[model samples]
Target chain A: MKYDCDACGPELGAYLLGESSDETRREVDAHLAACTACRDELERERALRTALGDLPTATCPGAVTARILAVVDAEYAATRRRNRRLRGVGLAGGLLAATLAAVLFLRPGAALRGASAEHYTPEQVATARHELIQTLTLTARVLDQAGRSTLVDVFNDQLPSAVEGSLRPLDDPTRGG
Target chain B: MTNETFHELLATHRDRVFTQALFSLRERRDAEDVTQEAFLRLWRQGDHLPADRVAPWLAHVTRNLCIDQTRRRSAARRHLGVADADAVDGLVAAAGGPDDPFAGLDLDDRQRRLLDALQTLPAETRTVMLMHYGDGTKLADIADAMGKSLAAVKVQVHRARQRLRLVLGTADGVSEQRGSA
Candidate 1:
């Protein structure tokens, strides 16, 4: 709709603010071309807007930037540390899960005393038992060095003498070697 | 965002945010506080906020915070029964330094008159004017932040313009009459 001066009077604000729709702007432009009063009002609005825009901007103080950066860096570092700790825990959990699977699948009667034993050749059973015993021996030595002997005691009762000899150093507190 | 990108954002947009808050609040300390708070908010959001939109986002947030601060201040003034003149004094005290809007302006008589007249506008009206004229924020954005209709924000700006014009025009006409006499 082509807004005349009367209709465009209130709409002048929206037009000057660039908030008016294209149709309304076109109408206002057409009206402004003919209406001196409206043109003068528009001029004043433009002048005021220009002056306000030209007003000097306030600068952010150096101190504030320093302060904000410090806080942001600290928070970012904390997030990184937490993520690293989570990754460590995930690695440890995966290793523990692998150890549990080895123990459950290769126990003395678990694979050798049933119809399941026929599925394996004699050579395969011998290799599997040998690897399982080696893994348990390494685990016992690690626990002994760490001074956590509760699980080591259980391993000592079940392991063969060949594996048990390697664990004797872990029981001697004065033996650094 | 990485620290490098955030530092760039701070350098590019801090003045814009500070200017908006300063003009809207008319108090240097409050404006500084608002600017710091807005940037702190930016830091909290971190890489989640897109880089290109940072300027307008900061402007919008700073304006809203200034408006809220203004409302709280006005409420306190009302509860304390502070008069208009005293509020002006409080403004000076709150300013406390070289945060004058007219600073470094080579203003003519009419421009000076307009600036003086601006100081007389009500807080909400002046805020609309500042956001629209000073900060160059869109009226639709101002309307959204002020929680007013677009029409209402426009009307407020228009009225502010008319008020400044009346004050400045009358002064000009009187001076011309004296000159002619």
Candidate 2:
């Protein structure tokens, strides 16, 4: 196959880099043989590659390497700590859940006995109900008194100043006159 | 690979990654930061990565970090009037180093011209070129890392070579004329 320079121009790097397939290499070779421009271009590419490839390998500073390792270490440690905390929390939660489940399943009557009517007789139940009502009524009275006290304080704080301002004239002429 | 082998790989490629970042970002501190980020990323993902993909993976991550840094630098420049003094100082310092790869080599006139010309290329082009030539990374790998098509990378590389050749050729002609005189 005949090779055109325009078509073959882009393949030059591939050819020099040995990335070109055999067939493409042959095509490039044929094109290069027939074209001086491409030939010169190829030589220049070769020179550039050689010059660039010959650049000495540079090493990162020792301190920079140490810093990188330190950062990685710190980050890894943090990750481990986070994972461990999560695991601890998860394990504790699991244990607690499991214990509760086991107790419910094994002593099925524990929940019932705590709130069961069997634990209290009729007289004791009536007395307990009466005590509960009394406690609730006292609590309600205390809350109502607290609310009234707050309102009284607010009114007392504002009333004297409000009355004084209302009785006083807006434009006092005694001092100015 | 085990921790030992991973460390070995890190030691082996440390300079390559640093040099690539240094050239790409044009600042030593930024390069170091990018290098650290890349290695840290590698360590985190190392277990899931294939052995062969390690080097290119580092290259890809480092380049991305450099690009991000460049964007940040530009933004900071715009908003805070922050200039890249570090980049200039880094190049100047690197120019004097006896062990600096770009400077230390006993290159000929043409090679030196090529090196100087390389600095003048766009950051992305110079990066791809350097990674390919300096580290011997494949174009396809560079493309994959940079999220570019292979063809695009090749084109950038081609343009870089073409520019360097022209610059070197011009320098060669002037030197030849002087020699003849």
Candidate 3:
């Protein structure tokens, strides 16, 4: 190839390391054969490398290796933990879905209307409608146990208030009577 | 290789690895951390590593880690506040004539002094020099690592060396050489 213009000086270090491509190595060899300056440069470089090697190395402490091993172990453990959690979530979700399916199919009539309708005043019907809408709204947003727990707590705290408010207006709209 | 063999190899090459890391990081603790991280990564990828390429592989990994560390540090609060004198010197000394034993000098003091003279070169040239001599990285690898062009790396190498010679001349109380890069 175009040996004269193509650069080999950049590959000199790799050449010394014997990591250069065969073609580049050949060019370097030929160049060294003819170029005394490049040859001298290579010698100084080699000597300098030896000297650099001779320069003192930092003393790694006893804990360094231990610390590294510990980190690797910890990472491995964490990955396993995450996988197990995901699997547990999947299993729980499957069981919940199956339970819901059984409830719907095994006893559809009763399960669908456990709190059956009975006689009620307009205020009671209004309260029931408000409670039903509120419960449905809460259940619709409950995506997880944690969120469902919070939703249940919100309904528990609000149903009584909502029911009271719904009938209070029918009984007496006045703030104080 | 088995763990024992790997550890033995590491123990054998620890000095070089640590030295390279130290020079790259310029901090003792950082060097140790990088060394361990590099080896740990090596171990994690051990199955893929061919045995013959271990030392150079370690060097290459350590060098890349150092470069990454430097880049990361350069971004955040300076993890290594220490200026990189080694990178400058690596390229400075990486390509001397193969026959000349460091400018034909037998004295270690003169050699050390000459190297120290590299400090005065322009910062960019010094970096190129360090990659060559300090890390023994090929010019192309140096260019790749430093994100510089081959021509740029060559010019930097040539200029850095020429400047280093002049600086050494000045350091040795001699006149600046009238030579070109």
Candidate 2 Cα outliers beyond 4 Å, as residue runs: A109-177, B1-6, B25-27, B44-48, B67-112, B172-181
Q: Among all windows of ten consecutive residues in candidate 2 chain B, which has the lowest summed lDDT?
A: B172-181
lDDT of 1 by residue, B73-137 (tens): 87977876768748777777888944565354355665555456766887567666766787777
Where does the lowest 10-residue lDDT sum fall in candidate 2 chain A?
A168-177
TM-score of each: 0.64, 0.66, 0.46
lDDT of 1 by residue, A54-144 (tens): 6666676787778778887898887666665555444434544676586666455554656474587786588557656656655554444
Model 2: per-residue lDDT, tens digit, A14-131?
7877887899898889888889888777766665566677766556889988887777667667766666555544544454455455544533343344556666556555544543
Give candidate 2's iRMS in Å, 1 decimal: 5.7
DockQ for candidate 1, C-alpha atoms: 0.29
Model 2: chain B TM-score relative to the native chain B: 0.69
- Using lDDT as the yardstick, the better of models 1 and 3 is 1
TM-score of chain A by itself in each prediction: 0.52, 0.56, 0.49
Q: Quick one: how many clashes does candidate 3 have?
A: 22
Best by TM-score: 2
The interface root-mean-square deviation of each model, in the order shown, is: 6.3, 5.7, 7.5
